[model samples]
Target: MKELFPLKQVMGFAFSIFFTLLALAVYFFNMSFTIGMTVLLVTAFLQAGLQLVVFMHAGETEDKGAIYTNIYYALVIALVTVFGTLLCMIWGYV
Candidate 1:
């Protein structure tokens, strides 16, 4: 019965809630834009990683390397697209 408790999942959920509350605090505390954004981004990435590892079981598969590689590739593409758009539209780099 002890092994059936799903401790990892419960801990992950609790951490997720904590991160959510931390993000919310940035708004309630009226933090500066930079600080708020920093906190939010940190929590968002941490939550995403936690969900991937804990809930999605990303590291439990034999092909975990491939899965993580794909994720990294996707992140790189997303960053490039976002930064490219910002450079052209907002930074006037066109």
Candidate 2:
């Protein structure tokens, strides 16, 4: 029974559920827009990391460092793209 128990996955699933509920609460509780967005963003990133590490087995491979490095690069690119767009289109930084 112990050998068959998927503890990590179960914990990850529970954490995911908790985060989902937290997001729902933040949405339905009529929180301020900025605070709500901040909470949601933080929870989203945490959930994403949990899913990647627990479900995706990100640390199981020999090239785990490369995998994490690539993920970081992707995140940087995404952030740059989003911020650049916001600056140019919304903030009128052209």
The candidate that wins on TM-score is: 1
For candidate 2, lDDT tens digit of each residue in 1-94? Answer: 9989999999999999999999988978999999999999999999999999999999899999999999999999999999999999999999
The true-versus-predicted C-alpha distance at residue 39 of model 1, in Å, is 0.6
Each model's lDDT comes to 0.98, 0.95
Q: What are the clashing pairs of model 2?
A: none
lDDT of 2: 0.95
Pairs of residues clashing in candidate 1: none
Clashes of each: 0, 0
lDDT per residue for candidate 1 within 7-47, as digits (tens), equals 99999999999999999999999999999999999999999
Model 1 / residue 44 / CA error / Å: 0.6
Which has the greatest lDDT? 1
- lDDT, residue 40, candidate 2: 95
CA error at residue 58 for candidate 2, angstroms: 0.9
The TM-score obtained by model 1 is 0.96
Model 1 clash count equals: 0
